[model samples]
Every structure is written in C-alpha cells, then in structure tokens.
Target: MAGSIEIAGLGKTYREPVLDGLDLTIGGGVFALLGPNGAGKTTLVSILTTLIRPSTGSAHILGVDVVREPGAVRQLIAATGQNTTLDEYLTGRENLVMFGRLRGLGRRSRGRADELLAQFGLEQAGPRMVSTYSGGMRRRLDLAASLVTQPAVLFLDEPTTGLDPVARRSVWSDVRRLADDGTTVFLTTQTLDEAEALADRIAVLRAGRIVADGTVAELTATVGGQRLVLLDHDGTEVRSIDTDGTAASLDAALGAVPDAERALRATLRSPTLDDAFVALTQSATDHQEAVA
Candidate 1:
C-alpha cells in the first residue's frame, strides 16, 4: 500500500519552476518540510490539500490522487495556512460550531465546538469574539476549526509564524497530541528549532528540490560531527575545530593547539539543525550552479 503521502515527478511552474521534479514518501507521524522562502513549501502543501493542481506528475494522499479525486482528498484532510481563517465577527466557540455545521455535523456541531475549544485551551475564551482575542488565541482557534472533522491528514503551513515563544510551544503541544491520536501531520516551517523540537522526520527543500531528509540527528550528521571550541577569557570563541565526537579526536585536536593555557575554556558543541540546513541547502545550490 502507498504511504499516507506519496509524490512522483511533481513539478509546478510559474514564470520559472517553483517546484522541480520531486518525489517523497511520508508514512505517518509529524513530517516537517523546512525551506527558506520561495522554496515551494507552500506550493507543495497547496497541491496535496487539493487547493491547486500540479503542473506535471502526480500526488496521492492515502492512495487517493489529489488531482483525480480532489473531493475525496478533501474528505480525508484539512489545512491551516499561515493566516488564520477564523471569522473576526464570530466568538471562538461559534467559529468552530460553524465549521462543524459546514462539515455537516448538524446537531452535533455545538458539542464538537465545545470539545475542540477545551482541547485547544480556549474554553474560557469560547464565548468571546475572535477580533478581541490575542494573536495566540486566534491561532489556537484556527487550529481547532481545522479539526472539526478530525481529518486523517492535517497540513500546517508555518502554523506558528507570528506567535511568541509560549504560543509557539502551545501549538507544538497540540500538534504532538494530534499525531499521538493517529493523525498524519505534514508541517512546513522556516524555523529550524520548530522542526528539531517536533518533527519525527524532516526534509529540507531548496530551489524546489529536497536536499536533505532524515531525523534531526541524521540530518545534523550530514554537516559533520561535533565541534570543539576554544574560548578566550572573555568567553569569545578563539577557534573551532571539527571532531568526530570521540575522546581520541578531541584529544588529538587539542594537542595541536599552541599555548592551550591561553584559552580559558573549551566546549564541545553538537551540530544543530540550523547547521545541517545551511550546509545541505548551500551544497544543493552550489551543485545547481555548477550544472548550469
């Protein structure tokens, strides 16, 4: 059987190709797509959510072709874009209830609205107009509305773009809970830390192609192993030496340092997602330039 999401030779173009020939498979859990702006992250999400058709190739969500069976795909999935889709005129509770009604929940709409409001920690604000809510509150309500039908697949495009740290984590917790309940989440984020904190697996996109795909540790390894930093008395970095994260390698690198006592301290730093993202994307760009 095909995975939850499958793509083959996918391409989209406007003026120039926004997405080149791309293939990816995601089975389940929270799969994050990380890319800089204009990397086609949103374009891909738009394709999968049935909002737009690919210029070429094909994609499927749970074996339903996004192009051929858009209605079927819509039935199985829901999307929350960067902007909130909530109505400012409606109360938080009313917004969710309205979504449920549109989804044909009928008499069950009110109950489901209350349930979702409570799930997203918006029960107290449920009766308040969304226009009066904070940015975080509006975001939570938008997310809640997407779940009115409990979709099998959920697509979040930069779900926490403008929220503060606390609000961002709150959304992260909600995403985790959804995955735990067996919802396949496809997340697109520009924030490296968000991918590190939440992704079960991550793929980095550059120039409309995937340059790296793996777990946080796996991707970080692509950039190389840990780094040894020598710091001055003022705690500024004097030098950084790459290491394989073994004691032998650390010792060998340290031994070559002249006047080691001049350094006040040394620290081993693990390669982060940011490091991997930069190295991988830069490599891809360099390769493309060479090919051209």
Candidate 2:
C-alpha cells in the first residue's frame, strides 16, 4: 500500500520566500500539486524528494521525517523532475540499468530494464542514445527510470510538459499503472486537464502559498459561482462563466423563464477544467489586472 504524506507549516525561501507556512496532507493514489510558473511548485517537490531542505516546518513521508531522515525519505521516494533526468549520452536501457544498479540491483536489473522499455513502448528505441529520443520519449524514459524499484511515493514534476497528446496519454497510463500498484503519486502540472483527469485531489499554490485545495469538483465549486456551456455533437463543450453565473444562468434562464429547454442534443453541460482553474488559482494580482 502507498504511504501517507503529512506536511505542516512548510516554508522555503530563494532570494524571496517561496513557500510560507504551507500545510498539506496527502494519502492516496494521485495527488496533483498545481501552480503556475514560479509558484514554488518545483521547490515544494524538491523538499519532498530530499533534493533541497525546507527552511521551516516538518514533513513526514511514509513515516520518515524528511528533515531528520532525508536519506530514508529519499529511499522511499522516486522522482522525475520537471526537466529530463535521462543521460543523453547513454541509451535509454542503459539509463534504467544504471539507476537499478544505483539502487543496488545486480545483473538481473538488465532484464527488468528491458521489461520497462517494452512496457513504455520504448523497446524499439531502448538501445539508442537518449540524444536521439523525442521529448515525449524522453519523458516516458524518465518516468520509467523512476519506477525501477517500485518506490512507494513517486514525484513527477510536470511529467507531460512537452509531450504530445498521445504521448501524454501514454505517460498517464503508466502513472495509473503505478498508482494502481499502490504507489502514492505526487504530481505537479500546469495543465488543468491533466490534474482533473488524473489527480485524486489537487492543491493550488500561488505566491508561495496554497490558495486552494480539494478534489477537482470541490475546488471548482468552491471557487466559481457557476458556468454556462454549449456543447457540440462530438461531446465538445465550450463554457463561459462569470461571478454573476451568466454562462450557466443563460442555459437555464430561458428554460426557466419560458419553460423551454434548448434542443442541444448530446452537448456536455459542465464547466471545463480551465474555467475552474482560473477561478481557484487566479490571485488578487489577476483580479486587479483584469484587462483594465
């Protein structure tokens, strides 16, 4: 089973403080740590992965104290940073085998690496240097390398950042497989759809603080009033929402007032994840600079 993570009063500073008394508890399959650029997302993951130390607060990962037992914490966690961690000079298979050996695995690690390469659809490219891999392929390899020992807690810092849709979905599939095997995944993503699609719970960080936290539905509802949407035959939905709930109100407005619902056949009638993200993650700075 995956272990729980408890973080209390997490604070970090770089030139300026990034995290300020951030508190969070995560214990589940997939936890999406959401934030925009420079929102301390990377910094938070760094501390959790023992790559950096937090200035303050206590964090426990899998019952190990990150501050006091960093090495222990590292051993329990597998991480794929926002940037590629694969060595461009080494073949994909080599990278995996190297990590496995680093984890103290012996010659048997080669067989295991080959299995992962095939599983990730990189079997054909396994022997090629990572320099020849595409962004998506590299991302997949990075993720695969992290799962070498089947770690309990996995940290993926924007794993799908530069991948194509199909490639992104492939990465997501691998992540789901890991989570289903009872790995606790802490993911950071700028893509709201990725968060909504994969995260069991999500937390929003802005200006070095958690502005919101909850499941996708909960966070969206907590932030925005309501939304109106027009959907296409192919299940494509376009939403428009305001603080006044105009987007949603209009859809129901005519129906309520005139008692006639529009004949929108097979149209999705929910707010897209993007609308919810803006509402939940947008800060006072956004509010004040709203195209005025």
Candidate 3:
C-alpha cells in the first residue's frame, strides 16, 4: 500500500534547532529534498522514518503517527542511509536471503532473493561474495535488501551520491520502477541533476526551514521569469540571466557584458530548476543576512 506523508509544525532542537516549524504534505510519487549539508534534509528523513523523535508538532505516515507509534510506522517504511550496511562475507544472494528472512519472509525468502537479484541486474553476480562487488553493485544490493518487505514508503538518502553516470542511471531506473509500482519515494540528494531528473515534486530546505517547495517548473516560475542564455560561437563562454524581460532587467543583464552587440548568439528560455534553486536559496541567505 502506498502512503501519503503529513508533517505539521515539526521541530527538532539539539544545540540549536535542526528543523524548525516545518509543515508539508507529500502525496504518493517521488518527493525529493534538495539541500546543502546541515540543511535538515537528513534530520527530516530520520524523523519521518521513525529513527528520531521530534521536539514539537507531529508527523503521520499514512495516518499513522510517527511519534506516537513509531513501531507501526517502521513496519510501513524502509530507509537506506548514506553508507552501505551489507556484510562483506555474504554473497549477494545470501545477503538478500538473510534480510528477507529477517523480515520474516521464511520459506518465501529464496524466491524474494532471486527476484531482487534479477531486478537489480545482479543475477550473474548473485553467488559472488559481496566483498567482490564494486561500489555501484554494493549500493544496488543495499537498496534491493531494503525492498524485501515491500514497504509502503522508501526513504533514500543520497542514493546515487558517489556513483558514476552509468551506475547513477541504473539506480534512477530502479527508483522509477519502484514509484511506478506504487511505493512513495522520499529522497534526499545534494545533486541537482538527480533531483530534477527524479522528483515529481521538490522542496528546498535551508537553515532549518523550507526556502522553497513545488514542482520543478512551479519553483522555477516563482523565482520570477525567463532566462537568457548567451553563448559564444567558439564555445569558450556561456552565461545565463534570469529576468522578466523588462527594459531595466534586460539592460542590467546586458550591461554586465563588455560588448553585448558582439555576442555570437543569445537564446531566451524559461528558467531551469537549477536557476530556481540558486535564486531561492540566495534570496533566503540575503534575508537572513539583512536580519542579522
């Protein structure tokens, strides 16, 4: 069963507040959390996954209160952290089988193990010791192990952080397939490309608050207007400007260039997700700076 997430006025405090007054609702699909280090991305994940308690407010996963009944919430979700946790002594198949049994699959464990092995493209490597697997392979096995119980929600923290392009794409495919099959995916990533490619909706967290949250296009539009891409014919220079195309805005953009009339080409385009992220985060920073 897929689930929706509801967090209301959630706050966690340690030294200072890690997460403060966060209120958000995430329905079924890929919900990506984009943030820099210490931006409360992982903290939010931990609270949602029942790994930690909130100091104030409440959160519910599929109507189950995360704080009031963490055990029940745990039964409905699986989380994979930044690091791998597989036993190197075990073979790929053995690891899956072990995890399946731990989840109480019992006699069905072997079949589930085979299914995951095939699903992750590890059928040929299933019998090899996990120590022999490469980084990407190990990550895939770790993810596959998490799915043994087929939880309603899956939290993947930095799932493809260290992967090469090919391996990253492979993980992307698996995530898409899971979401297609009705598992609500909550992802945290520092990679903008990963969030843009995978998230059906994204929320950018900064300084213990959500600076921005929406679909990629919606967030981009909120930052104001179209972007002008200026590229040199020799491919030596590329600059982008975000503006509403007002006379002042256009002039300011052009003024930055030494000779706008001599530019080889310029294209007026809609702002990308990257532009929205940077602009919104910068705006938040500026606001905090002014207050300080």
| Model 1 CA deviation exceeding 4 Å by range | 238-266, 283-292
Query: For candidate 3, which ten residues in a row score worst on lDDT?
Result: 283-292
Model 2 weakest lDDT span, ten residues long: 257-266
For model 1, residues 1-292, the per-residue Cα lDDT tens digits are 6799999999999999999999999999999999999899999999999888999999999999999999999999989997558899999999999999988899999999999988888889999999999978888888999999888999999999889998899899999999999999999999999998899999999989998999998999987778777788788777766678888998987886678454458888887777677677776666334322
Candidate 3 structure quality by residue, lDDT tens digits, 1-292: 3238999999999999999999999989999999988899888999998988999999999999999899999888988887567999999999999999988899999999999999989999999999999988888899999999888999999999778899899999989989999999999998789998999999999878998888887888886776666777775336766668687887776665556544557767776776677776666666334322
Model 2, runs deviating above 4 Å: 1-3, 228-270, 284-292
Worst 10 residues of 1 by lDDT: 283-292
Better candidate number, 2 or 3, judged by TM-score:
3
Q: Model 2, clash count? A: 3
How far is 57's C-alpha from truth in model 2 (Å)? 0.7
Sorting all predicted structures by lDDT, with the top scorer first, yields 1, 3, 2
